[model samples]
Target chain A: MIRRRFALSPALLMSLALAGLLIVVVLDLPPQPGLAGPVAQAMDQAGVGHPVTAVLLNFRGYDTFLELAVLMLAVLSIWSLGRRDPIPARPVQGPVMHGTLRHLIPVAVVTGGYLVWVGSSDSGGAFQGGAVLGAAGVMLMLSLPREMPMPPALLQRLGLSLGVFAFLAVGTAGLLAGHGFMGYPPAWAYHLILGIELAAAVSIALTLVLLFLGGRSRKVRHDR
Target chain B: MTVDVISPQIYLLCGVLLFVLGLHALVVRRHLLLKILAVNIMGSGVFMLLLGVAARGEGGIDPVPHALVITGIVVAVSATAVALVLMLKVKAATGLARLPLSGPED
Candidate 1:
């Protein structure tokens, strides 16, 4: 038999060439001090001890606000698609999964809350906490024997919009008070940021769980 | 002296490699799920690049990039959620989880 020729796919070749160029560029770059100095200088005024949290919630609060809006839009788009098909029945859960979940859900809630509270001075934040909460919700959705009914539509909507509304209210109040839009007075910054974080964490968790569900509430009429 | 590959710049190289790999997969793969995965890989590569760049600061890591990456992660998750739902809707309508190849006109 004739020896098989080795084939070189163009995609692989192109990717390799691109990677090589990128590697060369990255290696050749000079080191530069970033915004760390300015951030440190302004840390006291930022009202949060953690630099990352200061940047996220105080310095660039609008970005975080818009991010929440984007999350809301995603859920809305998913809901517009159609109602989720009913989850198929599964075999009864074993005691291990049941017992594990019973313990884990409470722990998850506490951990999520702790993460949000600790975010001001630590490495955790609303998003991290919200993700943990969302994971808990997903676990509940997957493991629960009976179909979990969607919460009342109005209540769910309230939770979904809570973050944005809280952000807007704070921003608008700032504007009216001459602190500028989204600006917190130095003394009030920490409390305001904390409040926003709590609301955002709740909304983010709800949005994530809704996204996982992947459709509108079953109570709503399906319109396609 | 051997080139130092263990520095933070190593992440930059990995990031670029990841971006290219994901791009290649995105172009070569036909399945919708693979496309979604490729896009996420590309996002991860960008995040890695940001972190790597942030690490280059002489004093301490740049908090701005850290914040940006955090925001980006949430945005990426929302986008992926929408994409997955769209993929499902496409499958429901077309009975195929892929796009129709548009070949050159005869």
Candidate 2:
């Protein structure tokens, strides 16, 4: 019988050793003191009790706006590639999947709404809410038959662009009021942030689902 | 040496480990899908590092990094989607999942 080498490969061992060293260096670094910066001052003016949301939507609203634009750009790039052949639909989902979706989708919608609402004062926010909605959309896509037509293109496009459009409108209004771009008046900040979050949640959900679907809208198969 | 592995340092170490693992996978893997997954893993590692640092900050976790990480997550997802679409386009055009390696003659 031929004897085989059992030791780890040199390259793999080297990589692991390097990683271990890097980890040690990182672990040895001294912890830096927290710099809340202007967060405390902005928090009261932000109109949201959750510090993270306040930071994301108010103090750093410009970042969020740009992030939405980035998402839109990604969708546009995917669309420009034209459509690919759709993955063949599963022959049929089991009764368990169909039943679970029937119950789960409604719960997801309610939970998503609650997440957005509670974001003002707690841990949840637009992204979390949007993800929940997106997950529901994915479930629907997987469970529903391929013959079921997708929503109209126009409606889908509207949903995709809604978040960035709302953000731009708000920002432009702020500029007109001499508050500078993305700066809402302190008194109106709460309502404005809420409006933006709602629109963003919708846009995010639609965009995420589209990303998962890939390329263009799927064509409904005539063979049932 | 006494090591408090349960502390934030451990999380930071984990992030570093993940980053290295992803980097290694990207270097070693020939399949486009694996590369994409490796890139995502790298992105997650960066996010983990950011959160770990945020957790270590005095007076509750810093909201600034948390907000930044949220933005990062969204950006990473968008980037990944674009990458996957590009990969699909490449595969469609060339009928090959992996790109051809550069030759010495070239």
Candidate 3:
């Protein structure tokens, strides 16, 4: 009973310690608010004129594009390792996964398309929506386990390169226009975001899926 | 509602439970995939704590940390993919998962 009584006392002591620490820190710290560094300042500035998408796709679009290329190089390195055993195609048949996909797949595809279409305006966009659709594909792959044709090699490469290609193309287009690389001089933010989102979705989805499949190693054994 | 009126008993208890669960999974699970899952659970626990910080900061919720969390999700997925691939290769070659067993007899 004494120990039980003191347990509450210890709890009170702990809370008091926390309160004291809070007061100490509040009194001791400087009152300056907002970002303390240049990088954060830059991010805030870039994100202000447009949604986070514009900052990612246009303001620092060159780096964003380069980042995708880096992902491509990783994929290419895997291919160069001489490990390209493609999965054979499988026939499709099933009650369909969770019955939800029956509703969700179409909805996700439409949403992805809509995001690609209206990417400049809202929370929904190609990157976010495409991932959703790709998730539908992953869901399909998991559920059917039998249906769906294996993705062709060229299509895979195209998917991998799509983001970089679009990024560079847009940047070079800007350069040719005398605005410099990735420049959005005249209110072309919407167009640029669209390109980035479209390419990025495909690139990210394919790269993610391929990464999943790349680990299998064939074994050879001979013994009677 | 007044801040003092609220009790943090559940959140703290859940945090501790999640933390211990992650640790248990990491130590006891043999499957590399499951261990990674446990690591993710631990990461989530830390994320929960960081979110609590964001919640309590004098300023309204910090967008910077939220953005960083978004970026972190992608990075975590990539790292997990890479680690799983490495584990699979090691498993294929050795035909056994995880570091070799430790024992009193060598």
Question: How large is the i-RMS for each model, in angstroms?
Answer: 0.9, 1.7, 8.4
Sorted on lDDT, highest at the top, how do the candidates line up? Answer: 1, 2, 3
Off by over 4 Å in 1: A1-6, A89-91, A220-224, B1-5, B103-106
lDDT of 3 by residue, A125-150 (tens): 44566666667677666565443455
Top lDDT prediction, candidate number: 1
Candidate 1 residue-wise lDDT, B1-106, digit = tens: 2354366878898899889988998997788999999999999999999999998888888999999999999999999999999999999998999866774572
Label model 2 with its docking quality class: medium
Off by over 4 Å in 2: A1-14, A17-21, A91-94, A218-224, B1-6, B101-106
Using all chains and alpha carbons, the TM-scores for the candidates as numbered come to 0.93, 0.90, 0.64
Query: What share of the reference contacts is kept in model 1?
Result: 0.96
Candidate 3 or 2, higher TM-score: 2
DockQ of candidate 3, scored on C-alphas against the true complex (2 decimals): 0.16
Expressed as tens digits, the lDDT of each residue in A77-180 for candidate 2 is: 99888874565766476888878888999999999988988898999888989999998987787777663467898998999999999999999999999999
Candidate 1 per-residue lDDT, tens place, A115-167, comes to 99899999999999999999999889888876777788899999999999999
TM-score of chain B of 2: 0.88
Candidate 3 TM-score, C-alpha based: 0.64
The superposed Cα distance between candidate 3 and the true structure at residue A48, in angstroms, equals 8.6
> What is the full ranking by TM-score, best candidate first?
1, 2, 3
